[model samples]
Target: MVFGFLTSRRRAGLRAQPVPPEWRQIAERNLAIFRRLSPADQEELLQHVQVFVAEKHFEGCGGLELTDEIRITIAAQACLLLLHRETDYYPRLRSILVYPSGYTAHGEHHVEGGIWEEAAEDRLGHTGQRLRALVLAWDSAKHGALDPTDGENLVLHEFAHQLDFEDASTNGTPVLESHAEYLAWGRVMNEEFEALRSAEDAGEPTLIDQYGTENPAEFFAVVTEAFFERPHALRRRHPALYERLASFYRQDPMRFVPIEQERERL
Candidate 1:
């Protein structure tokens, strides 16, 4: 209890402090989505970023050098998920490991008949409940920050895994506010997940990534990327899924687009 109070106080102080000029400049220069946010939302995101940067430990791997630019850029994108929602700054996530670029991860993959094969796969970002850390490739992260409409974002994809783990599991569902919300989330997410799988099996083009078919957990993460980055397309193609995400996130990313551009896209 005492520790919790002290931690809260420290975070309060961090949020109260004015955002540094350099940090603002970094967001403006690197994150196109930041400029699109309303002034109030922008301030809220910065406050969350302040607390997130202060709390999380960041390390550069693969000979990458850590800098404030890298930290703030990543934090801004992650905290975008927390805007207009109650958050604990991803309490289970303690460290962020950044690589200069995509890195190879060696792991075992289940082949068939209770057989597992060792393989190396290139990964841009990764996180797990047990690992208590998120990893990102700086190059991919920067591109995600720069291109807000790409329908792909490494930071959002990985931090979403952290959200999924909040309930002590890596299922598609996160901690919803009420029983009704949970039921709706489960129904909608399951439907969308299956639809994506069927589309993949048919070799049909999909708005959501084919990677989402990997599992429920990956489905949630991939959809989250599309939720923020390709809001118009997702809303048009899968309105129920988009509504569920908007309700959970408490933000309509469609509002972030300028009125003229929104009309053009529509």
Candidate 2:
């Protein structure tokens, strides 16, 4: 009875919520950045952006202040990913915490050498802490969104994690619609994951970011960044994985490939 009531209330809330004119304009403006997306995808993304901006609290972290420009800008990129799916694609994320700049936290051990080191605070991996949802360094997020090829958009990377964690643990595996799809997804992802690992091991320049080799979850996040920002390269070099992502993301990024050189390679 409780679950039913909550469900009904949730449905009512969704129904009561209306899209605003300003949100529509924001979506339309951001859509130009992703020219490869189809008209359908654009429309769908616009809706998701509208819903997300309305629902989530965009708070600035650290001492930095939040602004409407920052909130809407971040929402635009995060909502771009949902163009192919509905708002339910990111049910886990309830807030987007922003920081004026990157902040450091305490680390486990001070590795003065490979072995025999006392525990001391280190600066590495300090960004992994998630005291709040969707943490972003203001400058980092803004620059990353501005420069698509820079490979460090905090908005895209963090929001990608939220999407990956939609139905299960943040284990780099997302919930599929069917068992058969799951089986195929595992096989393909594992194979490509190993390929990425191998490339990183040999110090070979990988088209995908090396941070992807950190783990499966990071792999999913980093690959997602590539999927949206450098679709042509990802599809050309790793067509199978790209196809699976297209299926998962419900968007055919290949349709929007603007780089002639990248298309030629594919």
Alpha-carbon lDDT, every model: 0.90, 0.67
Q: Model 1 — TM-score against the truth? A: 0.94
TM-score of each: 0.94, 0.78
Candidate 2 off by > 4 Å: 1-40, 86-89, 107-132, 261-266
Reference-based lDDT, residue 197, model 2: 96
Per-residue C-alpha lDDT of model 1 across residues 1-266, encoded as one tens digit per residue: 12478888888899999999899899989998899898999899999999999889999999999999999999999999999987888989999999999999999987999999999989998898999899999999999999787778999999988988888988988889999999999999999999999999999988898999999999999999988888887888899999999999999988885433432232
lDDT of 2 by residue, 78-113 (tens): 877766454463666667777777666433554457
Q: TM-score: which candidate is best?
A: 1
Candidate 1: regions farther than 4 A off: 1-3, 258-266
